[model samples]
Each structure stands twice: as structure tokens, then as C-alpha cells.
Target: MTSIFYLHGGPGMSVAVERTRYPQAQEVHWWQQPPATSCAPHPYLDLLEAALVEFRRSVKERGAPMTVMASSFGAHLATHLAQHAPESVERVVLLAPTYNPEQSALRLARRALALHAGHADADKVTAALAAYDAAPGRARFWEVFGALQLLPDVPALYFGPQAGDAPRHFVEVLQQPGGFDGVSAVAISDDFAATFRTPGRSAFNGPVSVLFGRHDPMIDAEHDGPIWRAIFPQASLRMVDSGHFPLLETSLEACLA
Candidate 1:
């Protein structure tokens, strides 16, 4: 039996949502990165590297070859893990991954920073994030943030109307004091861009699978689908009926099969 590690998206999400999807796995490990702290650096890749170190330690302790199932931003980290530590991972599954930060929600976030910060001052970006964190309802922020991150017409995928509740829960459990600042730094950093290009095709020595919703608004099938296919020639590509977060709507058993 293979041990599976599930990675959640964003800088603030908990492992709870992902854990529920794979109840039957032999063992399920959820990757929890450091919380968003105002004092912490904003660049996400740095945080992601720290998470990878933890993941390697966890994998060693489990004594089982790992299978990684990651969604959205989590997928980005998973890709890096597979690239750098291929021997520890047996298989990879990426759900609605947005590898090209320039095309997805990160771009919107950059634009938002430009609008609010005037000239990309790190302090201003941090302040704006802090304000969003201090907002009364955390879930509302998640929903708004999700909408900004995902494509417009695909609210059902990332957040159904009920998603408001999710963000609230997320805020309660995952919101650290400096989380917003950390995420902002990561979103705007050039290091992430450089990492994306370098990991091109040699990242994984095992089979890789990618699942995406046909209606996914944030990631265009026409663009990303072909790129993935080309990159992972040995990979399997599945298109589901749902949007960005397909695991929320589709069964993990079916997806794994």
C-alpha cells in the first residue's frame, strides 16, 4: 500500500478539506506549510522550500514511497518536490495546477498590488494584505480571493455559492498573523517564475497525472492541457465535468482509478 500526501492550495488552507477526499488511502499525510505571518518574508517559493524539507522528513518517517495529490498552488510545490526529490515520490497527481503564474490569479494579484501600492513597495503590499487579514469575516476574504484567483465564470469549481462558509473556516484555522504578507511576497516574486522554467521536463521520473475541469475558468484547457501533455509524455490527462477544484465534486476513488 502506498502512503499518500495531500497538498492544499494557497498559503492559508488547512489539510482538512483534502483529507476528506482520500479517506481510504492506506495512510494520508497532509502537508501544512508555515502560517502566513506579517513578519515572515512574502516570497512563497522560500516557504515552499521549507515545506519540502518537512515533506522529505515525513516521507522518511512513514517508510513508504509517497504518492502526491496536490491542487492549485499546492500542485506547484508538488512539481518542485518531484523535480528535486524524485526518489521519494512514486506518482504525482496535479489538480487544476497553475504553473504559469503570469497567466493565472497571481497576475491579477500583481495588478491589484500595482493599483493599491503605486510602485510595488513591499511595505505597502504587506499593509494591504494585513488589512485584508484583519477584515471581519475570513471566509469572505477566501471567497473574494478565490474569485480573484480563479477564472470568472467558474465560481462553481473553486467556490460554489456555499464557498463563503469555507473561507470563513479557512480563516479561522489557517490565517496566521503574517500569512497575507507571505502570500503577497510569494505572488509577486520573480524566483517563482525562474523555478517554473527550470523544472521543465526532467522533474519526475515516475508517472504523472493531471486532472482539470472542462469549465475551469482560471486554467485554459486549450493552453495548459497541451503543455502538460507535451511535458509529461508518460502522463495521463483526464477532463472532468467540474471546474478548478475537481476533487470537491468528483470522487477520489474514481480519480485515482
Candidate 2:
């Protein structure tokens, strides 16, 4: 059987494994990039690609080739992996992938602000954003992140059973001292952002599957959907009714389908 790998977002974190498991691929393995610091200067591209290449090698005789479901930042890495090692990847599934950084950040920031409009602690988010504007550092970014969490952006209509517990996931990660800082450290590097800003190679012309939430604050569906379709002609786009985190927002059946 072909092995399926699920790559989570947050650069520093992994997807909620328990929530993403579905009947289509009941036992999909999860992959996370190495510490940005560990692979200093190179980001996690080489390491991730090497691992996936190994995965593809393992199941060569299997009925299917290895498939990757990469989310957000992982999507960027997955795209690069396929570009570099086309033979190693069977098909790429971009789940809320961050194909464009500048646009995605604007969309996410706007969603957080809208969710907190006129609500309690709204001032806090405003204050945090203001702080980020002034200092513009990782410390301030986390402050903004904590502030945004106060808003209930994940709608109950589409958010699955794990909706309520979503915030805790990031909170726990933040509580760990210097844990994810490396991710932020490398992420904000001028060199790193530029790589994604201008993908050196042409669009990935390969078998691909793209899924983005209709309510996703991180992806610009109107703009990105067409871009993705143009890049991967064989890709089938599925617009889900969820936010940035689909596993927490959509049902397994909906996700696997």
C-alpha cells in the first residue's frame, strides 16, 4: 500500500494527528520540519525532501506512490520537494497552503480583527498589533498571537468537535520556552521569506490536490485558487467551509472526501 504523509503548519508545530485521521487514509503518517535552527540557513527544505524521498523509495512496489497532505507552511515545503524530487512524490495535497506570504498575512490579520470587533479584549488585540507595528519582532508577534486567540474566529458551524480545544494547542506550544522561536527566527529571515515570495522554478506541473476552507483567514481563495489551478492543471480544488485549521473545523468524511 502507498504511504501517506500529513505535514502540519505553524512551522514549529504539527497538525492535530488525532483530528486529521480519516477513513480514506486511516493511518496516514505525520511529518514535521526539523528545528529551523538545526538546519540553520537552509530552512527545512533539504531535510524534508530527503525524508520524503526515502518514504517514496520504501513503497516503490506498493500499489500506489506516497502522497503528501501538506498544510500551510508545510505546503510551501511540499511544493518545493516535488519541484526538486518529482519522481519521489506521487501526488501533493495542499491543505490551506501558504503559497503567498504577504497576501496570506493580510487576510489572517484582517480575520483576527474582524472576529474581535466590538468584543471584550478587542482593545488587547489592537494594542498587540500596535506593539508589533512599533517593535516588529518575534516577541511582539507572539503577543499579537496571544491577543488574537481571545477572538472566537473558528465558527462552530464548520468547526468539528475539536473546535473548543484549538486555542490550547498553540498556547501549549507557546508555553514552552524557546521551543518554536527557531521557527520564527528562520521564518522572518529576509532570505527565507524571499524564497517563497518568488519561487525560483516554474509552477508545479504535476498531479496535485488542493483543499482550502471557504472561511479560511489564511488563504485568499479568489486569488490563490486560480493561481493553483493554473499551476497544477490536474489538481482538483475543494473549497471547504472552515477556517485556517480544517481538522478542527471540518468532519473527517468531509476532509477525506
Candidate 3:
């Protein structure tokens, strides 16, 4: 098995859920975004790149190129890493990656807002969005909105398929103090939304495996799947019978298939 850097999802959650739940027997370093350290600050692209530099160096010293396994927002960072440092990435497994920044941001806003619509918290959501719109800087808005998606999405996509204690886990983490630092990572990339370079065959020739969930509304496979397929010549995408979190709902072997 190749050495893997497991990056967790979230415009919210910091813990790399896949690190523990994946059950993959590989040498892995769980890399958290917006690291607890002070070196990582706003304009998170620089912060993340620095961390990747260290990861790249560590992997090279050991032997092979690093295989990056990232989900949700983490997948966006992986895409950037592959583009900026093609040589450092040996193989990549993108699990329901929100590759397109503009489209992803819009979709996240719509879906997350819809999650609260016609419900008791609909007014709260409306007010929050309105407040964010009024703010001069919306970075903190993303931090809060990022975590909002997990509330409804995770129960079915993650906990339902894998863990019996998902409800408790989700609640406990939401209640945790200072767990939202990683949400800024999503906001940090907003300014560069227009500049995301889609990887072409010439850019990266690595074997890329994309695992998607056909039923994921947050990331529609029909709309985004072709974009990814066209980007990487050797990239193969397998659609699982799950939601956004396919690995959580389906077997790891199934995702690889």
C-alpha cells in the first residue's frame, strides 16, 4: 500500500473521520486543516501549501510519491496540490470532491439553506444568510455554513451506513469548543475561485480514482462527473449507491471498484 495523507472534509469538522473509519491498512498521516498551530492563518492556500511541502518532503525521504485521499472540501485542497505540485502526487483518490469553486460555493449555499427551509430553523438560516450578505467579509459565514451541511447530510451518508453512534458523534463534535477553525479553510480559497486550474492530461499523468455517490445532491454526479473525467486521462470514476459520503455508506472495495 502507498503512503497516504488523509485529509478530512468540512468547511466545519476538523477530525479526519476517514482515518479511523476507513479501516485501510496503509501508512497514513492524518492531516488536519487550519492546524492547531499559529503558523496557519488566513489566505489558507499558503498555509495548506506549506503543510503539503512538509508532507511531500517526508514522503520523498521515505520512498514514494504520496497518495492523497480527500473528501468534500478536503478534495478541493487535493486538487490544488496536484496542480501546483504534480511531481509530489503519485496517485489521488477524490471522494465526492467539490472541484469547481464557484459552482461548489453556490451549491453549498443552496443545499444548506434548503436544509433548513420550511422547518423550524428556517428563519435562523435566513437571518444568518442575510447577516453574511451584509458583512464586509464573509469568511466567518463560510465557517458557520460549512458545518451546517453536515447536520442533515452526515446522518444518512455517514452514520446510517457505518456507525451506530453517528448522531452522538455529530452532536458531540458540534458542541466541542474551537472545532470550527477548519471552516476558515473554505473561506480562505474564495478569492481564488476564478483561478482554479482544471488538470489536463499534460498537467498530471498520475492514476486518479474518483469515487462518487450517485444520490448525492450536494455534489451531483451527472453535472460534475464529466468535468473530472475530462481533466485526467487515466482517471476512472466509480459511482457508489450512496450519498456524498460513499466510503462511509459503501464498502471500501466497492469504492475502489
Candidate 4:
């Protein structure tokens, strides 16, 4: 039997909400990247690939490939892993994967501003963008990205209203000590953002499933969907009515389907 692994986004975000979606009868390995502090310099890609390679080797069937389901930043890492160690991954599921970090951030910023129009905290979005404009550093870029996408008033931006308690669970996960900051560190890593700017395609020829939220404020599906389809010709792309957290926003069965 092929093992299933879940890689949560945020680099430091909790898997609490993600874990709840799996059926009790199924065994799925939840792989959480250590807080960005521990794996500095080459936060997501390098560190995660190495660990996954080792884990695949140590598994019951030595080096047996597994199915990898990853979201957001984790999806970014998963794509690289499938390419670097194609032997270790049998299947790939990407949920709202970030194709180009820079583009995605810009989209989020614009969406945030548009969504917050006339709202009192609208100034906050402007301020965040201003910070990035003044010093277009990776760190500031993420601050602006967060300001736009992770705004306290916009739970619907990620988990739509249909997701009962999911938005609250996500907030609780971020509230964990060092959670939000840790993700920031990964986003700000010197090379992390650059790597995803234009990751053309993956060499992994296995089955690939790409899920995008229609309401996602991150990447523009209409634009990136074709890019992803080109990346994996055999990929099955589905756009669902939800936000960034498709796993949490929709039923597990629907998401998997």
C-alpha cells in the first residue's frame, strides 16, 4: 500500500485543521516543516527534500514511493521534491500551490486592498504595501502579503463562510508561539522566494492533482492553471468554490474527487 503524506502550508502553520479531514481508518503522515529558524539559508526546498529522501529510504519498503499532498508553501516544496527525488513520490496533490511567490504576493496585496475598500483598516493594507515599496525585501514582501491575505477581518479570504469553525481553527494555529513569525522567516529567506518566481515544470511524470480555490486571493488560477497544466501534462486540475485553504473550505471527499 502506498503511504500518504500531508504537508501543511505556512512553513510553520499547524496541521491541526488539515489532520481533521483525514478518515480515521486511513493512515496519513503529516509532515510539518520545522520552524524556519532551524533550517535557515535554504529553508523550504533543500531541507524538506533531504528529509523526505531519508524518510522514503527508511520506510518499510525501502525507498518505496509515497503519495504527497501539500498545500501553499508546502506545495511549493512538494513540487521540488517530486522533481529532485522522483523515485520517492508516487503521486502529487497540490492545493493552491504558489507558482510564483512574487506574483502571488502582488495578487494578494491587490485583493486585500480591494476587499478592504472603505473599511477602517484599509489604511493597514496601504501601510503594508508602503513598507514593501520602500524596501522591496523578501521579509517586507511577506508582511505585505500577510496584511492582504491574512487580515484578521478576512477569514473568508482563506476559509469561506461554509467552513464552520475552520477559520477559528486556523487563527488558533497561527496563535501558537512563533507560528506566524516562523512562516515569515521562511518567506523572507534569501533564496526561497526567488526559487518559485518561475519554476517552469516538474520532471516527475507520475499522477498529479492540482486543486485551486475559486475564491483564492493568492495566485490567479486563470493565469497559473495553464502553467501548472503545462508543468504536468497528465495533471488533473479542478477549481472549487472556496478560498486558499481548499482542504478546510470543502468536504474531504469533494476535495479528493
Best by lDDT: 4
Model 1, stretches more than 4 Å misplaced?
20-26, 36-42, 106-198
lDDT of 2: 0.61
Q: Per-residue error at 109 for model 1, in Å? A: 11
> Which pairs, if any, clash in model 1?
36-178, 36-179, 37-178, 37-179, 38-178, 42-185, 42-186, 44-186, 139-167, 139-168
CA-RMSD of model 1: 8.9
Decreasing lDDT order of the candidates: 4, 3, 1, 2
Tens digit of lDDT per residue, candidate 3, span 1-257?
Answer: 66777667764465535555654645767766554334444455565676577667767786777887777767766776777777888888888877764445545565666755666555655665666667624454654465455445434433334335544555565456755565364545553452445566436778899887666656777788787877666788887666666656665556545
Tens digit of per-residue lDDT, candidate 4, span 1-257: 55777777755466665665554626467655555545356665565665566456545454477887888867766777777777777788899988776767667677768866777777877888888888887778767756665454554466555667777877775677644665544544546655545556788998999999887888788888898887788899988888888888776566567
lDDT of 3 at 174: 49
RMSD of each: 8.9, 4.9, 4.6, 3.3
Task: Give the lowest summed-lDDT range of ten residues in model 3.
Answer: 154-163
Better of 2 and 4 by lDDT: 4
Residue 147, model 4: lDDT of 67
Q: What is candidate 1's lDDT per residue for 118-223, written digit by digit as tens?
A: 3434444445445555672344334344434332222223443333344343444435543344454344334455444534774577889898766565677668
Model 4 scores worst on lDDT over the 10 consecutive residues at 182-191
- Worst lDDT 10-window in candidate 1: 148-157
Q: Please, what is the whole-model Cα lDDT of each candidate in the order they appear?
A: 0.62, 0.61, 0.63, 0.70
lDDT of 2 by residue, 1-257 (tens): 54666666756553444333343555566554455545356554444555556556544745455676677767666766666667666778877777765446545655667756888888888888888888775566667766776777433322334456655554454456643554544454333454444454434455687888776667777778777766566778888766666764565445556
The best candidate by TM-score is 4
